[model samples]
Target: MLVPKRNWLQQAGFLTGLYGQYLKVYLKTLVEYRADTLIALVAGIVAQGSTLLFLTVIFQKIPKLADWSFYELVFLFGLAATGKSINQAFFNAPFSLTGYIRRGQMDIMMIRPVGVLLQAIGSSQELNGVGQLVTGIAIMGFAGAHLDLQWTAGTLLYVVIALLSSAVIQFAVLLTISVLTFWVQEVRSVIYPVNWLYDFTRYPLEIFHPLLRGLLTYVIPYALGSFFPAAFLLRPESYGWAMWGVPAAAVITMSLAYCLWTFGIRRYSSVAG
Candidate 1:
């Protein structure tokens, strides 16, 4: 047992070191476009903030949306923002994979010793994700003060779990969509629906039709990624099931995404050099 444990630890450390090198290279490349990167960062912050401003305008006439007050909605939006920021910062490289495939760059990835999927994901880095992260932190802080909930050790642990799960779900979803481009070769049209997912986080699941709510919760699983986590954190007594659902749904979606990506790559038929 101890021998197996030691081997597992060694493998974990090796993988961590490999990922660290990938990250280091990305950070270096990000700084290479300092000026343009700054402009993009500012634009991303304003774009995300403007969405929240619109939400505020709509909610002014309606005090509660399915029993969710303005601050509660803010908390949900913060969770969604933080989850998206995490995806943008870490997993968004996969978003470019489709372009690489169409441009025949993916052939080079297959010859590399590193995992091809991981290599494809690490090809491009976005420094602008940092701006989204900063805004996410600000939103969470505002939600904390306005929502006003008593925190405990267990609740803190759950909050961390929720954040992690939310990130995983969003990352998996994005990856799955990107991988689809291997077959479709044109996914720009679907991007609008992807953007619309953010709307789901603004209100509680209860606000949607029962069938649509079930579809989001059980099929696409977006509810688990943001709404359920926010619901649990902001109203633990009323939504305790989310404590289990958030992490469970994330794990399920990740496993499925990994399988889909693997299958998609195996089906890949790139041209010869």
Candidate 2:
């Protein structure tokens, strides 16, 4: 039996390699601005930690949200924070699409031989998100020690996969929302509410009204990225399906997001045209 070899180029592997190189460049540039980077890092820490503190304060009063104990909800918040930090550090440029479009810089990107979508996504990286990463991991550790997760080997592996998949799903959704700038010209206004939706994932989705829960699960799928993963980790007997759906949802959302981004770029009317 003869099997055809996989075509790496056909799968955009080369473009991803270029994206990695761009990330290296972005990191270098970020390091070059040491003072600003320090300030940004501190600001990111304060901003993300303040949100966590706020959640903790609220949970202190209520003790739980829809059956999720405080420590369990901390795990959920950490999962969402990890995804957000990873996206910010890796694909922040895609979320800044409006600025490029407004300045007519996209034509330069379009002229490059590489894939424009990859170029756009890897154009910038928020090195400051290191703080958020630290905060998230710290919170996860705290919850693990306090929440009685009783994690077996398999469960621990599932948690790692679920967190990674959640990050991929988050990045995909942000990319899809940001890519709309190609047609909309300016998307800053829309991005605010979108940010709020992403922020919502930081809490237990079960706390939402049934209608909103159904909408998130069936339509937005944000719950899959944060709430479901947490529910699986903290209450596996009840939310067992999330152990499977985390990767499944990530694959589906990321595949669709890439397709839309490619289609959008194909429709791009360069600034000159």
Candidate 3:
């Protein structure tokens, strides 16, 4: 009797290769409409820019929001925005699973050997998010420099983990809701409110009522996207505990999304007429 080969590393490599192939095709479409990418990038930058301007004006009138100063708030905004832009650039496209299900267009993918979720995302390139990326990094850097942060090696490591965790939280929440379309067949019902929810992270979570704060942190887990980590960095003694929750929130929400997706796939039946 011989043990079966368990090539998990090979499987991981195969998945990576699949993602690379999908991204290659997705990006090629950008050349067909180069101006569109610029337009997209500009649109994101303008949206984020205008919000920052509004916040700036508000802060000029009042010195602080809750325990956070203006620059600290900006740091949170930048972190959240950057994470969102990265998601928009690379991962959020997969939420279109709802659209494919409704259109009966997912049949092709069902027959394919690659992961459906990965293929869904790799199918499209949203390069306009590049604007958000640039704006986010610049703002984060400006805020980080001005804000008196503890710049330890451990702190820097936490920042990097928090950034990634934020992206995962955003995508996991969106995909979790969007995955419901497999059964509901209503895209607007699921995706439209994600826009509203996304705004919850653009400022310090402390400003919200305790109930709402809990909703954002545990139910939606939006604070993990930026606010929690920013707070941890700004006042480590106070919010350092929240930093660990950032990655934990990501893992929990994403795990829920995975379970939801598995259920959705099992219940998935062709809507083709």
Order of models, best TM-score first: 3, 1, 2
- lDDT accuracy of residue 18 in candidate 1: 73
Q: How accurate is candidate 1 locally (lDDT)?
A: 0.77
What do the candidate models score in CA lDDT, each in turn?
0.77, 0.77, 0.79
Give candidate 1's error at residue 52 in angstroms: 3.4
Weakest ten-residue segment in model 1 by summed lDDT: 1-10
Superposition TM-score, candidate 2 onto the true structure: 0.86
RMSD of each: 4.0, 4.3, 3.2
Q: Best by TM-score, which number?
A: 3
lDDT per residue as tens, model 1, 142-200: 88887677677987788778878877887777777877876886775675487467567
- CA shift at 119, candidate 3, in angstroms? 1.2
Model 2 spans > 4 angstroms off: 1-6, 9-13, 150-153
Compute each candidate's TM-score over C-alphas.
0.86, 0.86, 0.90
Report how far off residue 183 is in candidate 2 (Å). 2.5
lDDT of 2 by residue, 173-241 (tens): 777888888788667676666656777777777667888888677777778888888877887798888
* Pairs that clash in candidate 1: none
